[model samples]
Target: MDFGFTDEQKILRQTFKKFCEKELTREYVAWMDENCDFIPDELYKKLADLGLFGMIIPEEYGGSGMTFTDYMIAMEELSTASVAAGICAGLAVSFGAKVIGGMGNEEQRRFHLPKMAAGETKYCLALTEPGGGTDIINAMKTTAVKKGDNYVLNGQKVFISGGNVADYMLVVALTDPKAAKRTKAMSVFVVDAKTPGITVNLIKKVCIHACGTTEIFFEDVVVPAENMLGVENNGWNKLVDVLNPERIGTAMLSLGIAKAAYQAAHEYSLERYAFGKPIGSFMVLQHYLADMLIEIENATNLIYKCCYLMENGLPYHMEAAMAKIVAGRASEIAAIKGMEILGGYGVCMEYDLQRHFRDYKQMVFSPISDEMAKNMIAQWTGLPKSY
Candidate 1:
């Protein structure tokens, strides 16, 4: 195994890190976190101009057509500065534009990809409904009935990220309720955000507030038949296709957050003194930093392995799940250790470590929980399915 970034990849990583350091300053991140609003148009446009939102898109569609590994490098750097900003940029390109790129008809791609790549349009995925959570595929309550040329959609989706300001949403709904299999009963459709009878209410959270999670209600919203992605009743498979990349992206984001927390704690240990001695001089504190470093290294390796598999068109579902579980827990552990090192400063909003702790805590339960990930591994290992 090469086990090293290419020269170009190294350059790209440094470039993005510099961009984050310059643009994603603490003041800007603090302002957005406090406001809890959608990412500002100016900031989105700046990211677009920097080509941050088009890494995975093909050049023909106004993107850079970069590999998944390149995208991961960018995600880690951006997320190190701010997880909320990283998610906004990464999702806009990956989960947001990827479905259309992979499943949409030629005309659909022509219509959506360029604008999405340019950040002129923002997209969100609506899959989880009230009480669905991780059981979304089976507990989905949304329904879409095909009419003459359009599908009338009804039902509600909760905890949808970017829903409030998204220009459009890729919505999954039950279209064949009587199908023998639950997976065969669902379909995916693109619905305009401004369509009639659609309501979006922002859900406030203790972390990553600027990402704009919301509850979206749909009542008789009409969507053109052409808006359907892939084959009817195959939305489940399409969902599976998109999830590997999303999970890997989530892992990279967690790794970034862990790195940030580790850096903060390391710097504080060197500078902060107790009993007329630097905290870094304590053997116990040294061990904590060492553990944090090891966790970050392990998570980074797993994430890069997933990225490599994805870029090379290899099967990565199991690996992605593993990466998510490892990275998520690693980030949580790093944050907790970092907090312990900082003591009172860790809980104070004045220090960024508190935000890292909060955000990493939330990540532990999202993008597939640790329990679900272990269950997947068990199934893949020829064990009985659990949950």
Candidate 2:
């Protein structure tokens, strides 16, 4: 029932907000969006120094061991400055570090977690494939076969963020294709990016340019047996931990984008005079802003609620889906509304509102599409499967 943050949590929020305000200004990120396909190494190292990369990792593994709420707070603040920052940071912590902390064994943790926390290592999760974007388990075609002393992998993974720059990649593949169910035989491997026969091809994306997306190909890429995460043929159950955090993080990023767009439009409305008065003074524009605020608040509440449920170790599958669906729509509306208010200026690359509009659209389809999220909700509520 508590709606307030603890002192430590408040400090976390302030720290990231201050950091974003200083480092992720509109001019800086707009430049990055135009020129770079990934966050520069220096900036990535700086974020690692700020302890952002260690939030989800356990203290035993050289991390801060913070709660998921703290992670959500950090996401919201960083996203307010730029969704790319939020996404990159989230990818490092939620998808990368957690893969080792939650699923990897002691040796793996001791070897990988410290470097991950220190930003000495970067990671990408390679799960999505050419035809398996949504119906991942059933459509998975990647295979890893046992060799004399290694597992030789042959498959492809698409839409992987930071795939080109990662020091390591957590890959999912079928270890037993003959199993009764595809979900029963999947396995996860932490493969070195330099492994032989691995190729990363950059995919041109219009949004979140700084975060980099790519498709990875593995042809006889040999991975050591020791690099396997969790038990053999049990990755499907364990992967949910990573997937759930990803959804919540995605929702938090959506909230941040919504806030950013709304803030930009709000400032413009008060200052831009029209017909002898501020445009904000007009009831129609005011109503749009009001609606934007309402949706933003609603999404914020649900995302934080998901954070709470996660921190408490409760089942959050349904809540995460709902949060994802609501937050995605809220961010989309805010971006569109901000664009409408800014008029001709919004479409120009000179303004940050357009960046928000473009970057925020990715949330609608990523992690899981809103339509897919709703379908998950339908199943959770005992409805017949629609697809």
Candidate 3:
């Protein structure tokens, strides 16, 4: 089988890599991470100008309507420079392309797609709750009741990325907690973030500080019936479509962080001197960097292949889970080894490695934890359900 980026994909990568080199210098990225919890408006606008916020949107909606592989390619490249920046783009792109473009009704599509494509709108997803993550559906306490012509929602969502800054939120809630089939008891709503009774509070975290995580409270928020996505009480069917891509995207995030960490550690090893010579001369340091590169390359290949399978209409869930698991571990290892290689400098604010060291950790449990991925993978491989 041929294994290479298409000419267009290569150009896409080069263009984005250039953008990162020019606008996302290490110092600047670190500054944003230190001082901001949301993407700066100017930088967000620049990303829009670069077409990152609309790559997967249909051309008719003013988007490129690109393939999943292309989205992954851009994600991996963007994350290499700054994962927080990449995440801001990722959430918007997925909401526009997947939710509105693929699952939204015609009116919803017409209303949201063009604005999202132009970066005139931003989005956040509220799926996880205070009670659970992997088992969120069964543990969900958020409820939505039909009222006249609208759905009145009352619930809380935690770990909502970019919620405070988003123009809209895709909320998952229980519409029929007593439904015989638990999977069909829930539905999704696209709600205005400024809707009355919606309260947002930011959650402080140690990594990826540039993109704030949040806990949101919806106290009888009213949403029109037209805003419900897909068939009512069948959000699980639709959510799967949104989530598989997110898993693959998470893998790309890990690979990007690994790439950044590896570069920092490699450069530092050659420049930092100890025992009258460069640290590069030490065999142990060489092994650390070498292993790190191997993990990054291996994880990258797996991630890309998963994206390709998804783009080509092949079964990709198992592979997506595996990719997330492999890439997350790879990134965690690369970050730790990066810190080890940089020694004390790894923890210092002036060194990018420290950011890499701190930031590579979120993926270990986000989107889907590595442990959760393993649980699903085990079942896929003919093992009994373990979780």
How well is each residue in 169-260 modelled by candidate 3, as lDDT tens digits? 99999999899987999998999999999999999888999989999999989999889998899997788787678888888888889999
* Candidate 3: pairs in clash: none
Residue 363 in candidate 2, Cα distance off native in Å: 0.4
Stretch of 10 with least lDDT, candidate 3:
94-103
C-alpha RMSD in Å of predicted model 1 compared with the true structure: 1.0
Clashes of each: 0, 0, 0
Q: Whose lDDT is higher: candidate 1's or candidate 2's? A: 2
lDDT of 1 by residue, 96-134 (tens): 778778878888888989898888999998988896678
C-alpha TM-scores of all predictions:
0.98, 0.98, 0.98
Q: lDDT for every model?
A: 0.87, 0.89, 0.88
**What TM-score does model 3 achieve against the real structure?**
0.98
- Model 2 Cα shift for residue 220 (angstroms): 1.0
